[model samples]
Target: MTFPLRWLWWLPVLLLLQACSSIPTLPVAPTTTPVAGVQGMASYYGARHHGRKTASGERFNQNALTAAHRTLPFGTRVRVTNLNNQKSVVVRINDRGPYAKGRIIDLSAEAARELNMIRAGVAKVRVERLE
Candidate 1:
């Protein structure tokens, strides 16, 4: 049996719409300045995420003291402060972002543990870009 020509045209349109809807919308431009009082939970990934290729094309290593930022350029270093404990650690940006809304950054598992946030699975923190 032959399909109708009209159905063929509609198939392309449906496929296009599906593709567009499936893509997540990213911010047009991300803020570079430090966000104050923007506290939320922070989590880390290791082992599984390690050695994987990052958005910046660098190999991810959980022990490397690296991080992911929504907007910061790759290789940019930032100081992450744990608001709950007042502890902080410097991390190099080597990847994209937390991807979850309301989360600021994604730190290596070691980094999160350093801030004493491993138990909580999250921490309130601030991220400041450094030169």
Candidate 2:
């Protein structure tokens, strides 16, 4: 013979648990060796996003060899290699991003053009941090 009021107490707790589970987690950057760098789809910034202040507090330069990585520390340099064309460019990690699903890095427009990826907008690549 439980009171009806007792069951209502669990409703708020259940809702809170559901809400916690729905929140997304921040992406963690890879800490592997240079030879075993992270691998994923790489995207590039467009003209629309140029000149904005990046997470590192520096203005984004579309023509610079810079990149936005979810977890790499600002000022860290990385070598991004395009597996399709075997082209590679070294870029400094000055921002955080590639927030889109499954992408690991976002390159500046100049970096993408060096890799011949401007036409594709995205590429399959490997990222190795420079020591």
Candidate 3:
């Protein structure tokens, strides 16, 4: 009986040791720097998604100067340039992503219009992180 009780106590100690060993000593933080010359398809969302709660919990405003970026942290400012018309607009990221596979950014309706991309629905643009 005493032998069994001793083994039970050691069992818990062994399990505790195993758990501690499994934990990583250090965790890595994700780097948020934007790659230079990153180009991709950009699109806009408007009345359909306006007034809805965004992932950041802010009310989505179609007229606001905001954008969605895949990897840029929220509050990052970027300059988006329309390659076709050479028009550019500065937008702040307030949301998580464009959600489309190949898209790197999603602009508000007004931003799209500013870039002269309202008709195309999608445009090839260059996104540069504003310092």
lDDT string, candidate 2, 1-131, tens digits:
76788789899999999888866789976563234477889999968888889999999989899999887789999999999998999999999898999998999999999999999889999999888
Model 2 poorest ten-residue lDDT run: 28-37
**Tens-digit per-residue lDDT, 9-127, candidate 1:** 88888888988886578767545645544556677878889889999998998888998877777888888899988999999988987987778889998898789888887888877
The numbered model that scores best in lDDT is 2
Model 2 clash pairs are none
Ranking by TM-score: 3, 2, 1
- Residues 10-81, candidate 3, lDDT per residue (tens digit)? 888888898888655787665776676688899999999999987778999999999988778788899999
Clashes of each: 1, 0, 0
Segments of candidate 2 deviating more than 4 angstroms? 1-35
Task: List the lowest-lDDT window of 10 residues for candidate 1.
Answer: 29-38
Per-prediction RMSD in angstroms? 9.7, 8.5, 4.0
Off by over 4 Å in 3: 1-31
How do these models rank on lDDT, best leading?
A: 2, 3, 1
By lDDT, the better pick of 1 and 3 is: 3
Q: Which regions in candidate 1 have their CA more than 4 angstroms from the true location?
A: 1-38
Give the RMSD in angstroms, all C-alphas superposed, for model 3. 4.0
